[model samples]
Target chain A: MSERLEEICSIELPTGESVGVHRRRFTGGLGPHVAIVAGIRGDTPEGTRVAHAVARHLSTHHERLCGTVDVYPCVNPLAAHHGARHWPGFDLDLNRRFPGRADGHAPDRVARTLLDATRAADMVIELRGAHPAFREETQAHVRHDQPVALERALRANVRVVWRRSAELQGTGTLAAELPGLICLEGGVGNRLTDGVGLELCDGVLNLLVVAGVLPEDALPFHWAAIQRPLVATDEDIVRVRATRGGLFLPSGRMWGEVEVGTPLGEVVDPIAGETLEMITAPVAGRVLAMREQPVVYPGSLVARLVAT
Target chain B: MSVVFRLEAPYRGEYALHRLTFGGNGPAAVAMVAGLHGNEVNGIQALNLVAGMLRVMRPKRPVHLLPCVNSIGADEARKRWPFDDRDINAAFPGDPEGAPVERIAAAVMDATDAELCIDVHSGATTVREHPHARVPLSGPELEHARAMMLPVVWRRRGDRYEGGLVGAWRGAGREALQVRGGRGLALDMDDATTLARGLVRLLAHLGLISHQDTGTPSHDTDHVQDYRSMAGGFFVPEVQTGERVVSGKLLGLVRNPLGGEPIEEIRAHKAGMVLAVRVYPMVHAQELVVRIAEDAT
Candidate 1:
């Protein structure tokens, strides 16, 4: 079976130029339709990389695929072109313009088109990267009420499966629109990390296997290679914030175990190099994320730990 | 001028919140603040003008003036904090130990201990708004806005003040209102003067200062209609801010970016004063081009 590549949305620039957002579709002996979307925010290149990797694997095993799989590699192409978090000229976050207006601006039109195109899919998987300020460990997030999504996310081969509450999900996000949407996020924003891409690509493939979009025999890696993730609730996550405006020097590693009061980082005066504040763990847990950039204002999130 | 709050900025000098007080401390205290959005120069100028007036007038009760809260942002002509791009106004009832903006917000909230508080602002960069007061449909704030007697009095719903400094002040059970004029990143001396006069009128209404003529009464209304561009183009506005127009009046024309003919001509749907007009020519689809506070039929 051959693959089909189609233009999902076209964005018009002020200079009379147009950029096309495309989707790659692979159909075998139709079992279930799954949509894998990425690059809603241009800064999240990790998602785009994983999307292409999954697309490449699907292309190679198109003949043995059990169902239809649609890969939206990059939705906000103009923003992706310049590596910006928002649409270049408008400064609008495409992710926030969901279930958008048909007759609205270019960003809103693209959002509406993408939401319309993926509404029919049985499963929708959104890929994202960590915030630009931090480096996060591999994780899958599902709405707390969605048991099927939670169950599917557990098989995504991530280190943590977070069942987040509706209040914490934020407004206008893709997951807010699609209740059962599974979100996979990790690594650094804008820049792809070593092994992170491969790990996420493998995870997407594994999810495809579980969804019956591809046969288990078609997976590139052994099933045993998948990590059994620690399921966590919203309360299990502890956000560690800086108390002083300074440079945050991280002392803890991502996913590293720590006891209560463990020194997570030390905020130092950038000029004098004097220790302004020593950040410590509040609970015995594993560090899920660590701030990479040094500069921090008071109350800046320096690190996040998942309580065991 | 006395420093009410201070915070150590990382690489720069310390951030200080300066308060200019007039009259001795008393039971009747009124606080007025501006420049929460650094780019909004009109409010800053208005407060400064008010400050100039207050320097000579002997007030019966205490009056506090916070002219420019976001001095750092004002220096760079940016609306948000230069470091984090966070809106200081949004961090209201803020964290004293939070970010720089949050600390400033908290300091502002703490400093504003008064019977009535006023937060002043300006229109967005792309548009120029007539000097006006935005208040609730029926409340003390509306009466206070009428006392200011600016060109326009926009009586809106209570829920509209659910966020920002005005909301935070209201949440604290204080009589708070918002006043705005001109445009951000630019100065309109006339509009600033109008705003200053209106503020003084409010002081006179409160019996803090001797009564003086401010200006003509504002066009009071509760119906504000917004006209948005249907397509991305160069919007050429036909009407200016504060101009009155009837329905079917040509408000603006959206011309194609290229040398083509006008793509769309937007017309007024209601008879009212033009509260706002898009000054910037380049516009995106659904961007506000004009706003009219429709007169009740």
Candidate 2:
């Protein structure tokens, strides 16, 4: 069986140049169709990299694969090209335009097209990177109500499996549009993180196996190589915010365990270089995410922790 | 005029939210706000014009005008708060104990407690809009919009007003409506003045002021059509906002950017008043080139 690259939607620029959102499909015998989508936001290159990595593996093993696997490498190419979070000219967040209109703007049409293409699949997997301002540990996020997604996320190679409640699922988000969608996210935004891409690629391949789209023996790595992720609910997560406006210097390491009162970071006066505030861990947990951007404001989120 | 809310800034001195008051101190009849999006200069100019008019003809009831709510945003000509880059308008009915924008939003809610409230805005920077009031299809809001007698009164679904300052006010049980004109970044003085006149007319209709200015009735309709480009190119609009168009009128032309060859000609299918037109020439495929508020059939 040969792999096929299909164009789902085309974005035409004013210069008569065109960019297309594509899907790479791998089909063998008829089985569950699993959709792997990435790069909804331009800033998240890690997700796009993972999508391609998975695509490359599927391409190499297309003859051995069962069922169908559709991988959308990068949805928002324009934003990805400029390394920005939103579409450049429109300055609109593609993530917020889910279930978009058929006759709307460029972003809206792409969003609508993406939803239509992926909605019919048996399983949909969304790949994402943390916000550019923060560096995050590998995690799989599934809606709390979705037991099947939660069950599938357990097999996804990641540090933590966060089950976000219905209330936490913001309106207009892709997660809100698809109930059983499993969102695999990790690493820093824009720039790819070491080992993160490999873990996610392995995870996607494992999912293909779990969905019966790919044969278990076809996976390059053993299924046992997948890490057992900690299952966390909304209550298990803690968000730490800064109390002062200054430059934040993170003292904690990524995925490092912390005790109560452990020094997470310090906020210093940007100009005077004086310590304005010392940020301490409020609970005993592991650092889930840390703000890499130096600038800080009162109530600005600096870190997120998952209580052990 | 007085400071309604204040926040201590780390680098800059204290941030102040000011309100210009007119007439008696009794329960305010109306509270008008603008510049929630700092780059939208038309609303700021319109409110300022209203403020200027209110100064001379003292309204019988108290009126509050909070012009340029996001002063920091206006300073940098940004839509969101400068410090955190968060939309202040989105943080409506906000928390005083929460983020900076949230605190400001909460303050705005408290300070603008009135029987009626209005949030003014301008179209996106790339599009130009005529002065219009967007209200529900029916109810007191529609009646009030009709009283404004602006160039256009577009009846929109209540669901569309789910998250902004207008939504917050409506949620709090205050009668609220939104009016917009011109475009962001640059001030179209004519449109701004037109919006101001409409507001003045509404105040007079409410018996809040003694002045009687019967502004021309609007082209009222709930049905509006947006014309989008089928292909990407340099869009040349044939009509301006507020211009009346007939069937088969050449609304715009999409021409190749490099060469002068015309790609597509957009024509109006039915007669209507132009509600919005794209000011920026360069357009992507499916981009909104024109919006027409059709006459009721």
Candidate 3:
């Protein structure tokens, strides 16, 4: 097995500064090809960490690799450069420009190039970033219609495998363009969370094993050590929103169990120092995500629960 | 001027959407909105100019002017709402009981009820736009836009107005158009005056005001072509917006900033008026450098 670093494309800025989006390719004996992409958003550093962690492991076990595995540590280098959600000057969200125009602007061209590069892979896994306002449990998301993707995500070492509605993915998203794509996201946006990188890294290795890119015996840990994730459909997940506008104090623990009416959080007036409303769980489930940014408007999402 | 709507903001005093009214109240001759985007100062300026003109004159019918909708954003030099960073324009036909932006959008919708509605805007901070009216290819809107006699009358497809305030008004069975000029975050007096003149012309055309028509006729066309840089480089434009150019005119040059090497030369394709020009030099690949409103002939 041999590994080669390849540049997908180089983008020249107005200052004649050139930056390249790169991928590390590990090629072994011919078999199924798997691609791991991360950092579509600059704020999602957790995904970037997980992408590199998996690449480091792949480098050590290249001899045992059965096929080719491509790891794109960070796709949007420009956004990542500024730690911003959107491209700096354009203020355009890169994730929303997928299957983009080849002859169009930088973001569109890069989107088109990335989409074309990964479309033919046997398995494509996207490492997504958490919304900056929320701290999420390690989770896997796939389209509800994609049973194969749903089944594959079960071993992703996540707390929940959310099979979302078609429309929920939104148009112009990476998941919408790529059929049978599995998206993994965790931690807080822009900040790295402890244990998330390790867990997701292990999950990727396990996925590669499932995809025949690596042998089961080559996994650093036993296959049985992986978490048995909860497979949830769109209907099973309920979004908890604040009824009153205030600063939210999250009381729910990540992946913690809950019964109906359990206290999840409270909304407090920032100026008056008074409690406005107490948010409680409406279903018997586990806390999947919690808003960490505190500021909330009426109808603002405070948390999400995956009903058991 | 009166506060048409208000939202209780926890941190700030409160978010107020104000409206300036003119003439006796009945069905309005027209409704004009500006500063939907906080940084688009030209819109705010043009609307204020119109208000000044209307204050002394008695209109046959009522006319409404919203000078600065996103006042908080304008105060902070941000394009969106300061606290949440949400675009107010996107929340059109919005819910009164929804988010702050949504409620503000709903209020604007409720307040801007008129025979004809015009949403005014400025180009982005990085680009300067000439005063122009964007209307449908063929409608009462196109005719009204013609009456404005702005520098350019851009006829666009209906689908293009599917999102913003203009779309919301059109969806409610009202004729709507957009008037844009100058650049965001800065004021250009000439472009603002041009926009104000166009609004005054529209009022005269509607018999709401007995104003004189003195502005030049607009370059009417449906062919507004955008020229994008093939590569990222420092762009130096040679022509100012509102300037006329014949076929194959040298418009701009994309130059390497590190060394003084020229990477690409951009030129006009046909006879037209420059509708927009990139102001900020630093740009990425494929970014819009210029937009031309091609002559009808």
Candidate 4:
């Protein structure tokens, strides 16, 4: 077994310079192939971190692997370069350009190249970060209809496994192109959180093992350390919104259990100390995501709760 | 102008949704909205023009005109909210306690509670569109659009009414339609004037304004064909908006940006009136170059 690095595509910049999308491949005893993709949007640095973490572990244990593992870290290098959510010049979300045009712009071309390269893989895992506006709990999202993906996602070692509806999936997304795809994400966007990187890193490695890309004995940590996640459907989730426009001060911790009518947050005047409204849970549940950015208007989502 | 909704802008002063009222004896009989997309200036100007007419010729029925909903976005010449980059139109049936844009949307929804509602807008910044009314294939809204007598009356399917203020209004059981013209970030005087006249004609048709002459719609199309560039380059339109064309007519050409070579020549497929033409020259592959409203048989 050995490791090899390859350039999937190079995006030509306006100034004649170019940025390369690189793939780190680990090939061992032939079995099933798995690809871990990250950084379709520049803001999701957490995904990039987990990708590198998985790569670091596989680098040392590639010799004892059962199959091949391809880690594509920071596919949108140009966007990642400026920490933008979309390609700077075109203002296009790379994730929304999947199954892209062969003769399109650099972003579309890169999307096409990455899609074409990973289409043949047995398992596809997309690593992402929480929306920039919130701090989310560690979770794995699998299309509700994909039982095989849902069954495999259970071993991702996350706090929750969400079975999302197929309609909720945006068109041209990599997951939409590849059925049975598993998406793992959590933590604050752009900025990495404590323990989140390591948790997600372990999650990816466990997924690779589940896909037979790597041997279980090669795991850096014991398998028993992974926490079994609560499986939830769309109906099990509750969204709590702010009723007043002001600053949102969250009272609850991420992934903490709460009863109905429990205080979730408070919206207060930015200038004065007067509280505008107290947002409370409408149902007994656990906080899956909490708004991090404070400024709010009426109907702004303050927190998302997963029903108990 | 009355402040229907107000919210504090983070560092900036504050955001206000203003509505100009006329012939206010009772509930609003007609509601007209513009500036939902901040960069679409033609709608804003057209609504203002209607407001000017209402100032002199007092309407028989109550009318509500929201001339500039996204004032901040208009100030910055942005299509979406400047602060969060959210499309105000997309936040329809808005939450009163939601985000600033959503709150604004909710406020606009509440403010425009009328018997007949119209959401006015302009085409994308990259394209120029002739003054037109887009409504459901067969409904009261389509009749209202016919009364408006815009240059092009596009009868589309209900499925196309998925989001935005018009959809939101329709979802809430209101008869709603959309009026589009000109180009975003730029105001075409003729298109704006046409939109303004159409609104006046609609008021007349509703018996709110006296003795208004309704002009006929130049083109009524249910079959609009969109033409796209096969290659990425500088798009040069051979025809202008509102120009009548035959099948295989030269609609546009995509030329190599570097060497000035013709990469691909785009031609019309059906004999119709050119409803839209690309204004911005630089285009990507598969980008819309021209749209023609096909002649009715």
| Residue range with the least summed lDDT across 10 consecutive positions in model 1 chain B | B6-15
Q: Write candidate 1's Cα lDDT for A148-196 as tens digits.
A: 9999999998999999998788767788889999999999989999989
Write candidate 4's Cα lDDT for A1-308 as tens digits: 87889999877542334678999999998789999999999999999999999999989888888888899998988788878888875677888898998876677888999999999999999999988889999999999999999989999989999999877777779999998899999999888999999999998888888887777888988989888999999999888887666789999988888999899989988887698798888999899999999987656788999999
TM-score of each: 0.92, 0.95, 0.93, 0.86
Report the Cα lDDT for residue A28, model 2.
80
Scoring each candidate complex against the real one, what DockQ results? 0.42, 0.57, 0.54, 0.25
CA error at residue A207 for candidate 1, angstroms:
2.2
lDDT string for model 1 (B147-190, tens) is 99999999999989988999999999999999999998899898
Error of 2 at B270 (Å): 2.3
lDDT, residue A274, candidate 4: 91
Model 4 chain B: lowest-lDDT 10 consecutive positions: B209-218
Higher-ranked by lDDT: 2 or 3: 2
Q: Model 2, A144: alpha-carbon shift in Å?
A: 1.0
Q: Write the per-residue lDDT of candidate 2 for residues A133-187, one digit (tens) a residue.
A: 8899999999999999998999999999999996687878788899999999988
For every model in order, the TM-score on chain A comes to 0.99, 0.98, 0.98, 0.98
In CAPRI terms, model 3 is classed as medium
User: DockQ score for model 1, please?
Assistant: 0.42
Model 1: how far residue B30 lies from native, Å: 3.3
- Worst 10 contiguous positions by lDDT, candidate 1 chain A: A9-18
Inter-residue clash pairs, candidate 1: none
- Name the candidate that leads on lDDT: 2
